[model samples]
Target: MRKFRKDNLVVEIYENRIEMGNSAAEDIADKIKELLAQKDEVRMIFAAAPSQDDMTSNLVKISGIDWNRVIAFHMDEYIGLPRDAEQRFGNYLKKRIFELLPFKEIHYIDNGESDPERICTDYLKKLNEASIDIICMGIGENGHIAFNDPPVADFNDSKLVKIVKLDDVCRQQQVNDGCFKSIEEVPKEAITLTIPVFKRAHNLFCVVPGITKAKAVKRTLEGKISTECPATIIREHHSAKLFLDQDSASLLK
Candidate 1:
């Protein structure tokens, strides 16, 4: 592994995606164990994407995590997809880790009632009820965090959760990831936790792989701290680490 620091963010480049994912899982598992030792339960928010596959898969296999004491939340969800839609972030997590573990609670964002405002208000309340202990996330090909695409990301966003339109690149990424058949099939709007929520989290573990992410990874580490590259904000986080494999780190200097 080649490790270095970019501002407050720690970046680790591994030989392969499997190694990168395993390393991130070990670190995240350690954080969860440490937090559970200090508190009654650990509140965690996760991002659902194909990029997170290896990490989530390995994370669930690690022993001694006390999964029953973990409370789960997903970072974002499409606004109009069916509850059982495979493309739904909530469902993605449910299949990946939520259902595999015995979490104390799994709060899902529901925008199906045609009332995105109410969904945001409800999710915000749940999030505000406790401090987020950790965030397991991935950056989009367009440098987005969660669904906070460049056009809509706000560094000073006051709302904990809000509905926003997905940018063209962000929508195209769904098709690229095979989550949707085409850009036209992707939902244009989504409910996402704001950037402030990420900044406020106690710890962040971002696992990004694939050659498709190389440019975004480069921007995240070298670009200015601005909403234009929302993931760049992770550099300002006190306890954030970015994991990458050769494919994703190819463009980094």
Candidate 2:
């Protein structure tokens, strides 16, 4: 692994996406063991995206994780999409990770609810009721974290979860990732856990791969810590670690 640091953030780069994923999966699996030893249960948050594919796949293969002692949750979900839309973040995760492992429970944001505000509050309560031990996430092509794109990210956001309009760059990225055939097909809005929620997690394992993410990776490691490039906030979290493939880390100094 090629390794480096940006302020408090630790960055690891591997030759290929698979290797990067394996390394992250090993570390997280070990961390889960450490946490479960002291607590009856653990809470984890996940980001659902193509970037997380390799990591989640390898994570499920690791032996000895007491998945029964874990409660799983995802960070964001599109609003106003058809109830059966295959592009929904929850369904993406269900196919990639949730169904691959057996966790005690899985909580997904109900994006189709008639009252988005009320559901956000209900999810916020669930987040506050437990201390999140792990956050498995990724940086977007536009440098967003979850759906907290530049325009909506707040370092001191008052609410744990909120509904917000998706910025153009963010919506277009879905098309680039093949989640949607066109930008018009992507949901214009989403419900997401705010920056403060990510900061509160005891450990943050960020998996960002592909050439498409090179610019965002560079800004995340070299830019000023600000919401303009929301992923830059990772530099402020001492517990956060970034995993990248050579393609993504290529532009970083």
lDDT of 2 by residue, 12-105 (tens): 9999999999999999999999999999999999999999989999999999999999999999989998777889888988988899889998
TM-scores of the candidates in the order shown: 0.98, 0.98
So what's the TM-score on candidate 1?
0.98
Instruction: Tell me which residue pairs clash in candidate 1.
Output: none
Error of 1 at 3 (Å): 0.3
Clashes of each: 0, 0
> What would the TM-score be for candidate 2 when compared with the true structure?
0.98
| Candidate 1 regions with alpha-carbon error over 4 angstroms | none
Best candidate, lDDT = 1
Specify the poorest-scoring 10-residue window by lDDT in model 2. 105-114
* Local distance difference test values of all predictions, in order: 0.94, 0.91
